[model samples]
Target chain A: MQAYLTLVRRELGGYFNSLTGYVIIASVLLLLGFSFTDMLVKLNATPTYVPLTELFYSSYYFWLILLLTAPIITMRTFALEKFSGTYETLMTAPVGDLQVVLAKFTGTLLFYLLTWLPLLGCMVVVRYYTGEATLLEPRTTLTTYLGILLIGGLYMAFGCFASALTRSQIIAAMIGFALGLTLFLLSLRSYMPAPPTDWGAKVFAYIAVGDHMESFVRGIVDTRPVVFYLTVTGFFLFLTLKVVESRRWK
Target chain B: MIVRPIIEVKNLTKRYAGHTAVSNLTFEVGRGEVVGLLGPNGAGKSTTMRILACFLPATSGTARVAGYDVFAEADQVRRRIGYMPENNPLHLDMRVRDYLRFRARLKGLTRRRSRLRTEVVMERCGLKDVDRKIIGHLSKGYRQRVGLADALVHEPELIILDEPTIGLDPHQIRQVRQLIKDLARNHSVLISTHILSEVEMTCSRVLIMQQGRVLAADTTQNLQQIMSDGGQVIAEIAATTEDLRACWEQMAEVEHFNIAPAEGSYQRCALTPRGSFDLRPLVYEQARLRGWPLRELSRSLHSLEDIFVHVTRAQGDGEGEEGR
Candidate 1:
């Protein structure tokens, strides 16, 4: 357990020490701030009675930004180690393969969650302007943050898996972006004109990240998406561990 | 008291997709013994070392390091071995001190122990000056020291160094060699290097491997005796080629000889005698009888390179020729 925490701490320090990490944070903050202001301007321009939290969460760009940024946070997780040949040093340590994977997964997840803190500023600003201390509607906000974590965890795990597959950070980032885009695109089946006419529609609806967020925005906490996201996250992280171990043979 | 060897391997083999890197290798390093794994390129030295270090599972057979099976009890084995892999893999982004501390902690040291060991190892490896420097910005010598410090951060029982002095300047090489020799006083070290002189200077026993197998294993002095068993001599005579050839043809001990045209009116001759005997005096007597001015006559000491070439080429089936 201590070894795992030490690895996690090192990984977190790596994220903070590198320029790519700071760039990701800055870009996420910029995009979220811009989108928040745009949503506010549109909401105030029109007297429509849209809920403030709902208005903040409705932007399609929110998911797109996350899909793009997930790769940045995770591309270096294993790829840089492999590229620099530190993987050999890492594997020969007393720590287990599962521990290394878990540490990287958790560290990136924490950093991913931290990037969303700036969005809370939008929440605070909205509450202040509305002359209400609790404009976020507690239940809606909690469920929405939970949805963000689950979905983002899944995306970052896929990025970690991608990083494990190759020693090139660029390739890892590309694979992560492609994988996240695929998941996001799979969810977009809900908006399709014909929407699948069979069980496919149900599967897509069940797995659609946007639908899950929408439900959370309506203050509904479903256990199915929680199980789905957590399972996918665990599966990807398991694949990452396998990839790390199999590299020895290659 | 029965003392177990620090490392023991029996018929260990590692096979890649295209070829076997190490095959049917068996050896052991006793406690406090410094063993040098000497081999030419593509001779499975690193493969064997990696197996012993618990970096890769062998394809067949078994290896035990520090009383732990490499395959079954890898973590325990890892805890006992300090491995500096080929090319000295290290985190280039971290400071030297920070990297050592991180590695110490990762090796399961407590906070105080990690800090103390980091300082001790940094000083031992001559890295105190570069502790605050980022690894990537440091020179190759300093980085190599950092790699050494990293390997020693936890002070494991067995230290496995693969090409520990590779690519270092002569002074740095000497310093690292001295440090390794100093370490061998308290720790069992298995070093694999192309520099045979390092082995001669530091190793108590040298293992010469070729074609993924042990060609020879003995003390440096004993290996030199084996190398010199096929006697070799060199002579420089101020005589015509035919004259020297005729004189050489008279001696029964001279098996064959090669003469190269040297400076003005002189020729250099290399002769392989039939038995391990000092043939210089006989060659000088022949030169005197023939009235040939003997410019130089000396027995060529058998060097490690001759042994390496002889063993590697003698068993050459043309399979283990791939670059490692």
Candidate 2:
């Protein structure tokens, strides 16, 4: 447990000590701010019944942030360690492979969560300007953040898994972006004009991150998306653990 | 009462995609012993250390560290040993003090213990001056010291250092050797280096490896002794080549002799003695009795380098040209 915490702390420190973490956070904030401004402009031109939380959560900017920031945030976890030759020292230090994978996962997830904190400020700005309390509705805001956490956790795990597959951070980032983009494209199947009927629709709905966020922003707390995200996150983390253990055999 | 060895390996073999790195190697390191692993490149020294450190798995073998099997109880073995790999990889972005503290904590030290050990090792490694400096900014010697400090911070029973002083200056190398000697007072050290004299100066026992096998393993003194027994005796005397050859042939102690012309009318005769005793006195007596002027008569002492070269070259010869 102590080793796990120390490793997690070191992983987090690795990000903050370099320019990678700040650059990621700054780029994300810049993108989010531009998207929020665009959304406000649209809202002013045409008043809609959609709540600010729903409008914000279901925007194209949300998926863009999720897809782009996750790969950047996690590309360094295992890839940089291997590149720098510190992986041998780290793995030989009495810590289990699972602990290392989980620590890195947690650290990246924590940083991913931190990057979205400014989204809350966007909500406050909305509430202050529009004088509407619904933007800050306690239940809706909480569920939206929870949904964001689940989806972000899954994407971060995918990035970490990609990072474990190679020593080059660029290759890791490319693989992570490719994986996340494929999932996003798959989820886009639900948006097709002639979407499949019955079971195919259900399958598309099951994996659609957009649909899951829409449900959460509407103040619904469903267990299916929660379980699905957690299961896939766990699976990716398991794959990373296996990759870390494979170092000894190789 | 019997004390168990800190490290024991039997029939250890590590086969990669095409070649075997370590082949049926066997050795033991007793408690508080400083063992030097001297070998040419690709002799499986690093491979063997990696297996014992639990960083690599052997194909067919059993290695036990501190009474725990390395493959089965790797964490137990890892906790008992501190390993500094080749090149001394470190977090370049971190400060020296922070890196040491982080490593200490990762090695399972408590917060308080981590702080204390970080301070202790920093002082011992002469890293206190650059504690606040980023590791990437430090010189190669200082970076190497940080790596050493990190290995020592955990206070493990055994410390595995691979080429710890490879790139250091002569003064830094001496300091590291002295530090290793000091470490031997409490903890066992397994050090591998291409520097033969460093091993002669520091190690209590030496393991000379070649082609993934132990070519020779013994006390440093004993290894030198084995080489010096048949060591050469060189003498410079004013004598003809034929006379020198005939003289050496008549001496029962001379196994083989070579006579080469020296400055003007002088001949340099090098004789390999059959026995371990010094042949200088006999050569001097022969020269005096023959009324020949003798300038130099000295038994060439074999250093660790000679023994290393001799043993490695002897093994290379035994395996024939195909082994190359």
Candidate 3:
């Protein structure tokens, strides 16, 4: 327990004490601000749509920012440790590799939340600008936040696995970005062909994180997509743990 | 020596890509013992040390560290062992105290206990003056000392140091040797190094290895005795070469004799003692009777360095295989 916390604290510190953390936050916030203005000002000129009054959904801009920042934030977790020789130190410590992986997962989760905080203002302003008192999209808004967390967790897990695969930070980031993009675009399988009947389309839909997240953003929280996102996160984290353990043997 | 060995390696083997890094190596370190894993480059000493630390798994065989099986309960074994690698890996950007605090927590100390241990270790390693300095700015010697301090703060029973003095200056080397000697009061130490004198001065026993094989394991004194070619006695005699040879051969105390130039009227005779014989008294008596002047006399035995080379080379030659 103490060992896990120690790792978590160090990783959290790494995200804040270094320039990489600031860069990710700045880039994500900038994208969020841009997309919110672009979608609100240009796309909808006439006011024919009725607004709900309560909590505004932070979905549209949130997903875009998460997609871009998740890779940059998580790609260096294990890769930098390996590159700087700290991986050997961490391995030889009394802690198990599984605990180290968990700490990284949890620590990056904290960094992701920190990056998302600046965008919450956009949520409040959207509520104010609509001139709807107590306006909210509870079901869609809640599910969208949940989706963002799950998908971000999934990306970090995938990036953690990639980080474990190599010692170069750049290569780790490239592979992580490539893998996340592939997994995010799994739903596009239907556009390419007939999918060999419905089963192939179902399977592709099952694998695509973006398809599941966007579905939640529309106010429908389906159990299958929720389970799929969680399974991907768990499976990738487990693989990361295995890789870390094998490194000691090699 | 203790009633039981602190560490025992039973037929431990580790292979890598069609090459064996350590081959059925066997040795034991007793409690409170300072043993050196002595060998040249790529001698499998580091491989053996890593296995003992529970960082690397063995290909076959069992190693028990602190009475825990390495593979079956590696975490338990790791908790009881502290390892410092050759590279002296640390977060260069982190302050020294912060690093120690973080490492202490990782070693399973509670928050309060970690801070206390951090303070204790900082003082012990003479790092109090630079506690707030980032590790990158420190000198190589200080960094190495910090590395050892990190290993010590955990208070593990066995501390394995790999190439601890690799890049330090002579003064730092001596200081580290003194520190290791001081540390013998509480922990059993296994030092793997290429410096022979470090072994001679700091280690009580040595496990000499070469090419993935254990050549010898014994105390410094015992290894010297075991590897001694034989004892040689130098004596002064006034007799001529043929006369001295004739007289020395008649005595059962002498095995072989050689007459060589000596100081003044005396000649130097090098005699190989026959099976533990003391020929000094007899030689003096013979010189008294002959009225021949005796010059300086001395006895010589093989030094540790000679025995080290002799044993490692002899092991390689005996096996008819190059070092792995």
Candidate 4:
């Protein structure tokens, strides 16, 4: 358990100590800032969600940003280790694959958290401006935060698993994005007339992080979504562990 | 064989695709013996070291490091072995001490213990002064030392260094070689390299492997026996028709000493000796008797390179030239 935290610290330390994390946070904040005064944010300020809502509406935008930024965080996590030939150094250590994977996962998640919080200026500014005028309940706020966290965790795990699959971070990121998209798209059962349609849909939805992410978007917290996030995170993390172990075989 | 083996292996095989990375390999490293794993490229030294370090599992067979099976008891094996790769793999962004401390923690040390271990390893590896420097900012030699410090921060019983002197200047190489030698006083080491002098200086025994098999696993004395068919002794002298019936006989290395065509009165001759021996001092005494000009007296032996090329070529011809 302590090893897990230390690995997390090491991973997080690797990020903050470099420009990748700062770049990611700068971009996220830049986008947020750009949306605030830009003509697009001013035009799209729907009564339902703020102008920032429209900026974040694509989800795919953040997803795309995540897809781009995540590779930088995770590319070096395993691929660079393999390239620089340090994976052997780490693997040969007394640390288990589980601990190794968990550390990387935690490190990336912490990077996400660090970046995610500063961007929450939206919530803070909303509170400052609207006072009680804002209709965001505590539940909705929690759900939104949980939604981002789950998605971030899922991406980190998937990226980590993909990283273990190869020694190239760019290739791993492509593979990770591909996997996340396929899983996300598979939830549309009606779009496909396949025979295992319902089962496929349910399975895809269960694994579809976005499906779980929608619950938080609706500002509704549910046990199913929590369990779904945990299970997918666990499964991907386990796959990362398996992939790391399988390296010796390769 | 005085048998107190700290590490043991049985028919270890690691096959990749149709080609075996390491094929039916078997060897043992005893406690406190600095064993050098000498082999050419594709001879599977790195593969073998990885398996022992618990970084890789063999396709078949088993290895035990510090009495722990490398596959089934990998965590325990890991707990007992420290490893540095041919390349000094490190997170360059992290401070030197932080990397060592993190490694110590990852090795399952508690907070206080991790700090203590990190300090000890950093101090031992001569990294105390640069503990605050980022690893990337340090020179290659310092980086390599930091890598070694990370390897030893946990104080494992065995250290597996894969070509620990790969890409360093001669001075840096010598420094690290001496460091490895110093390390061997307390910890057993399995140093894999093609450099024979590094082995001869730091190792008590050499394991010359080729084409995924052990070609020779013996002490320097034994390897010299095989590599040198019969040693050649060079004798410099300033006399012709040297009386060598009884004088050269005392030097066991002087198998057949003959006077070459002497320039002036100086006798220049060489002795084709039997079985690894040095006849320089005896030749010096022989020169003094005849008042010979003794300038250069030396014996020639095959270096690790010569030994590797010879043994590997021999093994490869039989194995159909592995990996093309």
lDDT string, candidate 2, A14-95, tens digits = 8899999999899989988987988798788987766677888656788889988899999999999999989989988989
Question: Which pairs, if any, clash in model 4?
Answer: B238-B266, B238-B293, B239-B267
Please state the CAPRI-style docking class of candidate 2.
high
Question: For residues A1-250, could you state the per-residue lDDT of candidate 1 as single tens digits?
Answer: 9999999899888977667778888999889988888887886797645555677777765786788899989999999998888988999999898999999999999999988888878887877787754456777778778888888899989999999999999999999999999988999896766546678888888888888888877678889999999999989988888887885565
Docking class of 1: medium
Question: By summed lDDT, which 10 consecutive residues of candidate 1 chain B come out lowest?
Answer: B315-324
Reference-based lDDT, each prediction: 0.87, 0.90, 0.80, 0.76
Q: In candidate 4 chain B, what residue range of length 10 has the lowest lDDT sum?
A: B238-247
lDDT of 4: 0.76
Question: Tens digit of lDDT per residue, candidate 2, span B1-324?
Answer: 788999999999999999999999999999999999999989999999989889899999899999899999998999889899999999999999999999998988999999999999999988988999999999988898898888888889999999999888998888878888888999999999988999999999999998889989999999877888777889999988888888889999888888889998899888988867678889999999999999988877789999999899988788897766
Candidate 3, superposed: residue stretches over 4 Å from native:
A36-68, A123-142, A190-197, A247-250, B1-3, B227-297, B321-324
Best by lDDT: 2
Q: Best to worst by TM-score, what's the order?
A: 2, 1, 3, 4
The positional error of residue A234 in candidate 2, measured at the CA in angstroms, is 1.0
Q: Residue A220 of model 1: what lDDT?
A: 87
The per-prediction tally of clashing pairs is 0, 0, 8, 3
Which candidate number would show the highest TM-score if scored against the true structure?
A: 2
TM per candidate: 0.91, 0.96, 0.85, 0.83
- Best candidate, DockQ-wise? 2
The stretch of ten residues in a row with the least summed lDDT in candidate 3 chain B is B224-233
The C-alpha local distance difference test score for the whole of candidate 3 amounts to 0.80
Worst 10 residues of 4 chain A by lDDT: A49-58
> How big is the positional error of residue A30 in model 3, measured in Å on the Cα after superposition?
4.1
Q: DockQ for the candidate 4 complex?
A: 0.69
